[model samples]
Target chain A: MASKPECACGDTSAVAGGKKRIIFPCAGTANVGLISNAAAFQLADEGYGVATCIALLGSADTGLRRRIAEADEVVIIDGCPATCGAKIADLQGIAIDQHIVITALGIDKVYERNYTEEEVERVVSAAWEGKGRT
Target chain B: MKIEVLGTGCMKCKRLLKNVEVAVQELGIAAEIKKVDDITEIINRGVMLTPALAVDGEMKVSGRVADVKELKEILKG
Candidate 1:
């Protein structure tokens, strides 16, 4: 097994106010994952924090640790209640500013090809509005 | 054999599941493909990313969908 990434905590600088936004998507196996990806994309299209890979930011060999630690805010997107993104951030010792779970927002889990655009917008807007961010 | 298309039911998940079926048919493997939609259950297996593939309870891929060729190779191995 690949060892979990080593973590160094605390970003007092971003805490003081920075503009960098970090978004992470759990990208799980259902509509929730699609919803999260859609919302993240919409957020990016609307000029929110840049859309980058949560895995890239969570990398064990790169500067993901420092980037997340110093980010103005971190938006974690989990497809379902499993909250893979949120748990990963917590484990990595980085502070999570926001958390969005697709299934928690009323999207049912099913095997299908279509996604709900309205739901994606709502979730992304919620993340942008700082509903769960603390 | 139990084959799991690990995602929360996204397009990629559906696609991967379909591809898995195709690969299994081509390879003539009698595998039951299941969709793992529960985030908690998925993570309990130690996979934090989605759109993964697990065969017989062993995680093989995560965060992206594997094509038919790759799926065939994975199932063959």
Candidate 2:
């Protein structure tokens, strides 16, 4: 039997692409935070960019700092208007190319983590559509 | 008591040094404050972020510039 063709589609770890993009999601305990995290994961699975932790930047991780500096585009997703992810990026001197707030998308910020895939897709589409450009 | 300021000479680091001095003076504690300016040395001490405060060779905080009030709290406790 002939070997099947290799399918590397939607591989978030595929670094061979021309432009390198990294995403920082506000993975807080709230619903909006969960939404932001889920959206980033879906986007990463779709080969949009690699999803990374914002806490590393908060702690000033040297390796992650260098990666952020080298990335072509850095996306920051905040769960609410507080924009904790954006603030961390700023504190660590990391420039943000896109800043998305889930609350601004008409998504209510709730303490419970009850987010649907539709909401996650909405955020993913917002990222792809460049709606979060600051 | 040994209070070390770990940084690579950023503006915040300079501010942190001043804050540390004032904190020590205000508390009237016999503490030796040393500024660690080398990047490699700072990282070797397990501090990737500049403008960090280490008390008795223990990492307290990093990345953010803690205010004088916060410094006092950290130093005292």
What is every candidate's alpha-carbon RMSD to the true fold? 16.2, 18.6
Best by lDDT: 2
Error of 1 at B49 (Å): 38
- On residues A32-106, what C-alpha lDDT tens digit does candidate 2 reach at each position? 999988988887775567899988879999899888877778999999999999998888878888899999998
Candidate 1 TM-score for chain A:
0.77
Residue-level lDDT of model 1, residues A1-134, one tens digit each, is: 44332111121122212146777778665777777777887766543565667676556535776776666678888888778888877777778877877777778867664786788876765664454555
Number of the top TM-score candidate = 2
Model 1 chain A: worst 10 consecutive residues (lDDT sum): A5-14
What stretches of model 1 exceed 4 Å from their correct place?
A1-18, B1-77
**Interface RMSD value for candidate 2, one decimal?**
19.3
DockQ of candidate 2, scored on C-alphas against the true complex (2 decimals): 0.01
User: For residues B1-77, what per-residue lDDT tens digits would candidate 2 score against the true structure?
Assistant: 99998877755466567778877888899999999886667767776445678999998967544545667888889
> Which parts of model 2 are misplaced by more than 4 Å?
A1-8, A11-17, B1-77
